[model samples]
Structure formats: structure tokens, C-alpha cells
Target: MSINVFAGSRKALVASIALAAVLGSVTASSAVLAADALSTASTTVTLSAKINGFTNTDWLNGVWRAAPALSIPASTANNAAFKVGASVRLADGQVRKVTKVYVVGSNLSVFLDGAVVDGNKVGAPNVLSAVTIATATTSPTTSSPTTSSGSTTTVSSGIAYASGINNFTNTDWLNGVWRKSAGFSIPATSASKSAFIVGATVKLADGQLRKVKTVQVVGSNMSVFLDGAAVNGSVVGYPNKLTAVSGSTTETAITAPTQTTLATSGLNNFTNTDWLNGVWRKSAGFSIAATGANQAAFKLGNSVKLADGQVRKITAAYVSGSNMSVYLDGAVLDGNAVGYPKTITAISGTSTSTGTVTSPAPSAPVVSAPAESTAPADTTNGQPRLVGVNLSGAGFGPSVVPGVHGTNYTYPAESYYKKYADLGMKLVRLPFLWERIQPKLNTPLNATELARLKQSLDFAHKHGVKVILDLHNYYRYFGKLIGSSEVPISSFAGVWKQIVQEVVSHPAVEGYGLMNEPYSTNGLWPQAALAAAKAIRTLDSQRWIYVAGDRWSSAYHWPHYNTQLINDPWMRDRKNNLVFEAHMYVDKDFSGNYFDKAEVFDPMIGVNRVKPFVEWLKSNNLRGYIGEHGVPDFSPSAIVATDNLLAYLRQNCIPSTYWAAGPWWGEYALSLDVTSGKARPQLPVLQKHAKTANSCSSIGPL
Candidate 1:
């Protein structure tokens, strides 16, 4: 039988071969007859179970068996086919063609036609194509074969679909953005299947164009994956959704650029303990003071390699009393041992002060300006002194407190408020936990917790003392850090809203303190406090809101918070309705641990260092609160410093609250607990400034 042959493109070759089979007498086309010797040709065959042999002359019985190297089990469970006379493609773009085939264990192995190796083995499964038995004579004619332009896929035993395709290797796919319309259809036909191969890009119904990573075929059905996930549809009936993006379009992962100006002023106002201790990369305008400086260094931007393996941005130079501070990234790094990383080998500029002047010795504090302000009044009878003490132990954690969580609460005796009232105190700062208020995000306050808190408020009211509800969690909820990805600024704001809504109606509640000593990292405190302030104003619009600054709300860090405060929406929306809070402890380390001789005499460690902070507040026409201040009565220095600090607050008309008075303080140094109807040693100093005894009798609740 003469078989008609035609040589041309793949589509033409397939059609001519099929048509010629029906017209058996047709002659070979001139193109086919004059074609070069058959160097390469391939076809497809279904994979089947391996048999022992050629099946005892199965060709006569019309039972076709797999050729050698075709009996191996495939990598996947899906049906597969073989393409004969085609070269197997490897992942590295190398190809090896099979010349001879044989069965190896239920699998078949191919030999290189005649080449002999000890095992006659190349490998299993990496082979590209296979061939099927045909009736035509297996002979080659001489002619130059045509080379195909696009890739040719071969169905061979153990050959997985699109196994070596890499989208990243082709700049055409990776560099250009791709798209597809809604409801695009994917083709399931074999030829179309080859076009929508793995590593191709496809658009989803949501308009997101993602790379196709997974493809599966079972019988006639096909599934294509996008964004590492599969789309829902039958392969053939879906719309043709994918198209190469030609116009300007956005990449899914790339966002529009945003500019971040380096924090210049906030850095100078805040101290970074890390940057201060690190090796100073000093330059012409910046200098690190080994001893005290007569003149302040000129503020200049620089970088510091921290011990924690982070590079920090530093700016600003501050001379606070005897201690000098270098501000970095919105806070001062406090330490003596901080140094530069060894990797930083060079300094870019000289270290010098812009205006050097002779300075006093370390014993004398640098005085700035006197604190002056029209202090807001409190709910007192004919007087406006803020002489109340803090309730220390009730805010302890692990027990549920209304509007808070993670607190093990303690309730002071109802008589303590009366006791403080009897001492002529006019206000109380009631510290509380955040976890017990709203244990879960977006959840309401616990009813029982609210009742307990109301009881405390009633006690304060019964004693004629106004209450300042304090969030004592230090700007955190359990393990969740505010201003972070886990607990965003809105979470803090939302919780405050719940707290304010529940207690805004209470007459004894004078104000809300956002957070106590919010010493947070990442410059998050200002934003977090502002969010909470905004939330509170949404419901209780007219109430006074107190916001604490970063670095434990240190009086030293007041300048930074002042800058943030002026720019805060809360400040802009409600002018003269906000109060800045700061904490002070007169100790050697400023942590209220141990007192030095200068704790009393040296203004830097006591009353003098706060002059700049007070001046800043007064200059901005902003009122503030000494949220927490305490000095131990162990020595005369502590007593003297305590007296001086209170005098400073009273003289400036700044509302102030003593650190704490609780039943559990016992002998704790800073405790001002009243026991046996007698106050702690610090009580006399507190009473000396009471409304009736001082000039603050005219001030009232804010």
C-alpha cells in the first residue's frame, strides 16, 4: 500500500496524513519525496500496564504491547501517552533520544541504539518522546527537514506535563504585566492544553492577574491554577480571560511610592538610649559629650550602629541639667556603654559644637524658664488643688477589669477614699488594666468589671474626690503591642471609645488618662494616643483627655511630644481640651530606685531639669499634668527634693498627682499609703500644697 506523504507545518502535516489514509492510492507529495533523511519524527500512544514480553506474537492478534523503556509507572496517577522518535528534554535544556528499548523491572529502559555501557542505562522518566507502531515502511528519504519555531511538547512514558517550564526564565512573561477579563475560559483540548502550560499567567474574575502554577489533566477534563491556587471552571467552556497587558498598568506586588522624611526635630526632643551608648559617628555639627558640654552641639543628622544589630538615625543634641542627651529616631538612647558597630569604619564629618560657651559644674542644673500657666480647675469645694495620691495596687493584672484585660485586680477599702478625703485631697488617679476592660478585640467591657469600677468611682465621689481613669497597661493589651501590625492604632482607639462610653456619665469621673507611661518603640505613642483621643471625642466630645508621650512620658521627652501634640488631630479639633502627662522619679537612675545627695540639692535630678519641659508647655499655650512624681522619704535629700518638686508644680499652677497610696505599700520607698489614720512620710509634703494651704485654691477641674 502506498502511503501519501506531505511535509509542511505541524497542522498541515497532521491534516494531510489523516486525509491520505482514506485515499490509499495517492502518491507522496514532491515536498515529502524530496525531503531529507528522517532525522527526527514523533507520535503519541497511551500508557498501559507492563507485561512480561511481546505477548507471544501479539501483532498477528492485533494486541499491541509497549515498546522497551515504555513499561515504567508514571510519576502521577493521570493517564499519559508516548511520543516516538522525539528527543527527551531535560530541565537544563539538554536532550537525549532513545534508540533502543527494553523492560527493566516492570519499567522499560532505552539503549543508545548501539553504544555499549556496562549497564546500558541513561536514566528513567527524563526521556522526552515515544513512538507508536504504524503500517508504513520505516525508511528515510534525503531532504532538508524544516525547523519549527515554537516549542513542541512530547508525550512520553514517565514524562510529567510541563515539568521543566520556568516562567521567570522568559522575560516576555516575567517583565510584562498580564491580564484577563472576567469569566475567561481555559481550553481542555490537547493542543490548547499545551498553550496554557504551567508557569503561565492568567487573570481571575476579581481582576487580579496571577501566575499559573498548577495544572492537572484527567481524561478530557483540565484544571489550571493561578496565584498558586486553582480557578473554578471546566477547561474548555471557560472564557478566554488572559491577555498580555499593553497599556500602562499596575503590578500586583508593587505599590505607589511614598516619601518618608527623616525625623529631625522629634529625634532631638526624644532621647535614644542605644544611640547615646553607641560609638558616635560624629561630624562637623554633631558631637557626643564625654563630659558635660558648656555649649550644646549643633543638631545634624547622622547614623549609629546599635548593639542590637540595627542602624538608627540620630539628630538633635540636648543639655538637660548635668546629663547630656543625644536624640535618635524620636527617643534618647540612655546608656553609658553604647558604641558604634565595628563594621562602620569611617566618620563623615568633624565633631564640634556650633556655639561653645563656658558651663557651670555638674552639681548645678541648667535652668531655662519659669513654668507659668492658667491651670484648669478640679471638682473641689471652693478650691482647685490636685493633691490626691495614686491608688497603686488595684490595677494589678490577670483578673478582668471593666474596659481592660490581663489584670489581676485589687480593690482598695471603701474607707481609703474617705481617709484621703479627710486629708483634704481633691482628686484621685484610679489606675486600671486594659485587658479586663475589653479582653478581646472589638468586644464590649465586662459587666462585672464595670460594676466593680463604678463602686470605686462611687467611693471617690462619696469622699468628694474627682477620679481620673487611668489605662495602666503602658500602651499595650496583654501581649499585643499597640501601633504594631498585631494591634493597630485603631484597636487602641476603639477600646478607649468603649471605656469612655461606659463611664462618661459618672459625675466623679473628671478626665480620662489615655495610657500611663507609654514608653513605646517605633514612634507609635503619639499616633496611638491621638487615635484614642479621637475615639473618645466621637462619643464624649467635651471631656478632657490626657495623652502621655513616649519614653515613659518623661518630662525630658516633653519637647518631642509637644511637636507631635501640635500636629495631632485631637489637638487641632479640640484646642485647650487636652493635657500632656509626664512621670518623674527622683533617684540616681531616675527610676525611683535609689536617691543621691543631689536628689535634693541638684536641680537636674529634681526640680531644675523640668524647666525646659514646663517652658515648652507654657509657651505653646498648652496645659499639662504631672501624672506621676515621687521621692522616697529615706533621707533629707528625698524630702527636700519632694518639697521642691511640689513647690515647682504649685508655683507654676500645674496640676499634679503624687505617685501612689495603697494598702499594700507597707515599707516600699515611694509608697504614700495612709495607714492607722496616719499618712506616709511624704504626706506632709503633699498636704503643704493642698488648696487651703497654697495659692492654687482658685483652680478647678479641667
Candidate 2:
């Protein structure tokens, strides 16, 4: 995948190929490309500033897109990367223009002006995506991350499975059924199960192994489930007309997977700086450090394999002049610390089912709620439903507050829910950390927390609002959930047990979020997490559970995990329960529209921003919501970002809540009127414009 890394004012649009060159043997830089066609012209812009982490390819990608505006419509040669003799020219010339950023077949070479530079590129093979410059040597830039609506995806899971399917069956019937059934009341029609003939896109829920696919029967009536728990029979966007049909399986092309070479960055430790970098090194621990011109490997873990039987554990490591001191778990591996790769030795891990990793697709991707587009049109629709927010009570703030402070805050817990309930709010999001409820492994929530939780549930019940208690944090880095007391990763099951035992009886607690942003660094989530979810099913059969996307909930990352739902994936209380959730926050390119300085006054550019994500949800047959979104109100720069955001919601018809409410976020508050002191100028915007959710009237497309 091509990444756009920006370096200062200049943005670099590099692919995962072209970044193997050295610039002054200095710190790695993020650079953007300037367009200069090889057709026979030259327009150059001098490198102004530089920043680390950008590849030359990043600049190439940016310049290509921004070309129309630069008024320099340079043509591209074959989709080649730094394949010698490529150049570009601007209206005025001074800088060299590079095109086609592709890494040179892993040898890691760069064409600077014209010469090959080596011993410069470093880092893990995939961790640092490279760039390809038209020529060997090109300056670099970076892709600034802006976090937009469509790109950043949050995949949420549900608990539902059909019965009696063989090992690894695509489960086509179920796939079509789920999509057709998504966002609607079920049993509305008597069409044969064959009606759900169309196949679906497989999507992975954050941290789960069993991939699930949702598809729809054109013109069939169904039930709607928001975040896994049924919301209402009348779905806002569900279509009500079924098209008469023949059923057939749709097939797609799958390209043969190709093997790629790995990078060997900092390798002074061993003459062969090959198979022992990053975690691959059996050392005590490791951390990424930047050096003046380069970086190298350091140790933090214990008993590592180094050159010549070097055995030791790391005690400490810090910069000493130009090089890094090594510390093994007991000793350190002395070598270049900058530009280090994990390990050159080919190490492998088993691919086990964590839940659903890849969703099976029998048909092409569909991003709209199912309808017989070929059948009829129903312009007449229904009213939208009332909306609410998930402040994720009993949750956390790794960004600012970390561990236990959420409980310490009284403003939102005691005050905000009451206000939202009184404000005619329809929902409130409450995310729970499994580790918090059951501090001890295999145990349940301690008495104090249980009692407090029950009281809050009772309070919400008293007010006219529904509660969505989601398990926000899961077993992760360092074993415990982020921002919570440290606990063993295995403690997840214990926490689940505690939750079902304590809250299963309460009617006020409407739904549950399985885990918050379960990011599978690459794609799939950890397996243990899915098993914990299954256990939760045995406890509360009727509860609506939410599964999310991995990689911090980026939707782009979800497609790889999408799969067809198998029969009886999980049967809780005999109810076909749950909904899928996806979060949004696209990469910088999609969100960069925020910088359109053209608007002296706040001008909206994201009118089309929500299109991509909303379309994705509709096509997947998953009932979804924008769980979290917000900006520091003080950043007037976001004035346009904010305006574009609201417009995005209106255009896509997706519901969302600001990142927080009440006073807990003293610095990042959208508004403090509810209490907790996080009040900002954007309070009313959330109240009136947050998540435009509603019950479906006649059915089809909200």
C-alpha cells in the first residue's frame, strides 16, 4: 500500500517500495514528490525543511494528487519505481522532480541525482513502509495523519451463528441472510431462505478469529440491531421491496500471493546483520531510538542470541555520543542501534483462528443497505430515531488520564448521564474494562465496583435512556488493558464472568461492546479475545455484543478479515443476537481536505468525506455507528474540520458521539455544561448534530 508521509511544509507520497536511500547520512526524512514528467521537461522546487519518518514515495504520491492545483500536469511513465531516467519540471524550475516511487527489489538502493547510496535505510520490513523515487536519489517528506471519518475504521463484533456447517464452509445462505436482515425487524416477510442468495464481503471484528459476512435478500423485511442488540423492527434505511430472483454464487479473482525480501538495517552486532533484529532478538527487551544520522538495535529483554554465542540480558540503554549502548536482559548487544530491522532470520508464527480473521466474499462489495435496485423505488421513507452517546463510563484515557482516574471523576458519572437522560437522549455508551471488574484472575467485579455500577444502571433506568456498556479495553501491550491496573491477559475471561454475573439481570443495560479498538497490529486480533467473547455468550444469552475492527479500528484494514458467518457461531439464550461496528479515521490524504486554505471563512470540503465509510457499512450489511469523534475546540483550524464533519454525518446519515462529555477532559472537553469541566464552545454542536440516528420508518437506506 502507498503511504503519504509529510515532511514539514512539503508532503511526501511514497509507496512501500522507494525509501532505501541515504540523504546526507542524516536522520531519515519524510519528503513529498514534486511532479516532473519524463516526457521532456523539468520543474524543480528546492527542499526547504526535513522531518524524520517520511519516504521519498510519500512526496511522489502527494505531488501527483496535488498536480492539478500546482498547474503542473506532468504525465507518468509506466507504473515504475525509480527505474532510471525519470524526472519532472514545474512552471518555474529549481528542484529535481521524481516520479514512480518503487523500492529497488529489496536490495535497498536509492538514486541520489544519479548515484546509488547504501547502508542508510533501516527498520523492520513492514513496520516502515518504503518509497520508490523516479530516480535513485530523491528528497523525502511525510504524510500527516489527520484522522478523517471514512478512512479510520472501527470494526465491532456481534454474537450470532448458524447451526451445522462443515469445517470452513463459506456459509453462503447465512451470509446473504445477515445482510438482508441487517438494520431491520426479522420475519417481516416469508420469502424462502434462498432469497438471501447474494453473497457478502467478509469483515473481521477487532480481535476475533471467526470472520462474519452480512448480506441481504433484495426487498425482504428484517430486524435492525444497533451494535448487536436489536434496536427496532423498522430500520431507517432498510428497503421494503423484494425482487423476484434466481440464486447463484458470485466469484471474485484472487491474485497469487508473492514473497517479498526483508530489510537488514542496524547490524553491527553480527558480521551477518541478518536474522536478529527487533523482537526477533531473544533479548530482555527493545525500544526504538533515533540517532543523529542513524539508529541501531538495543536490548531490553533477557537471554538473547547474539554474535559468537553472546548471551545476556539488558539492564539499561541510552545514547552515548553517536552510538547506542546495548544491554541484554543481563547484558547488551553492541551494534548500530539506528535503522534496525526486527530480525533477518525468517521466523514464522502459526495462523490460528482468533475468531473470524477473513470474511468470505461470494459477491462484489456492496456499500448500501440491500434493495432490489432493479425492482422498485420507495422514495417515501420514515422518521429517524432519537440518539445518544457512549461516554464509556468505567473506561479510560490512555491519552491523558491513564489507570483508575475515570472512576475518580464524579462530574460525568453522577451528573452527565442524568442530563443526557433528561435531554431526550436515546442512548449512552458505557465501556467497561474487563481487567477492572475482575481484578483477580477468574474472579468477578469486586463488591464496591459492582455496587456502584448497579447504582448507575438504576439511575439510567430511572431516566428515559438506554445504556450500551461496552468492554472498552482488552488484553494488550504489557498484558493489561490500557489505562487500567495491570493484570494478566488471561484475566479477560474472569472479567467476562464477573460482568454476566453482575449485570445480566439488569434490564437497563441494553448492549455490550466486546472490546474497544482491538487492533491486530497487521490484521487479525488476538485469539484469546474471541474465546473470551464466546464465554460471555454462555452467561448472558440475550445480551447484544459488539465486535470491532483491528489496527486501531481502521476500516481499510477490516476487508482482509471479513468472512461469511458460520452456523451457530455462538448461541446465547437461543437468540440470533448482535450487530457489527466500524469506526472511522482515514489516513492524512483523505482527511487533508481540512487544510484547504481557500476558505478565508470556514469552508466545508468533507461533503463527500463520509461517503466512503457509510457506503462501506451499508454494503457489509452491518448495523453501525460512529462511536467516538471530536477535536480540541480551541484549534480554530478545525473550524472547517468541524463543519466538514457535521456535513459528513448529514450526507452519510451515520450517527456519532464526540470523544467525551462532562468534565473529565479538562483540556480536550467538547463542552462542560454537563459537569466534569470538559466544556468547550462545541457543546451544542454535539447536542444538536451528534450522531443523526433514528428508527427506520418504511425501511431502506438511512
Indicate which candidate wins on lDDT. 1
lDDT string for model 1 (131-151, tens) is 332223232321221101111
Measure candidate 2: CA RMSD.
Answer: 31.4
Which regions of candidate 1 are displaced past 4 Å?
A: 1-377, 398-407, 560-562, 572-576, 595-605, 674-679, 693-702
Error of 2 at 38 (Å): 76
Count of residue pairs whose backbone atoms collide, per candidate: 61, 164
Tens-digit lDDT track for model 2 on 1-702? 322212111111110011111111101111111221121232232221111222331123122110111111111322232222223222233123231122222221122221111112221111111132222213221122111111222222121221211111122223222332222223333442322211211211121111112222223333322111111112221232222111111110111011121212243332232113432122222323325422222322112233333222223333322333333222123233321443321111111111111111111111111121110111111122224565543554322223453333221355666676445454566765544455555554566666756667656644434466766653253344432345443465556655765555443555566666654233224344455566666555444555555544434434544332212355211133444454543224332222433323223433343444456556644444555544445455454555566545543434454445543333322333422344466555555553343323312233
Q: In model 1, how large is the Cα lDDT of residue 144?
A: 21
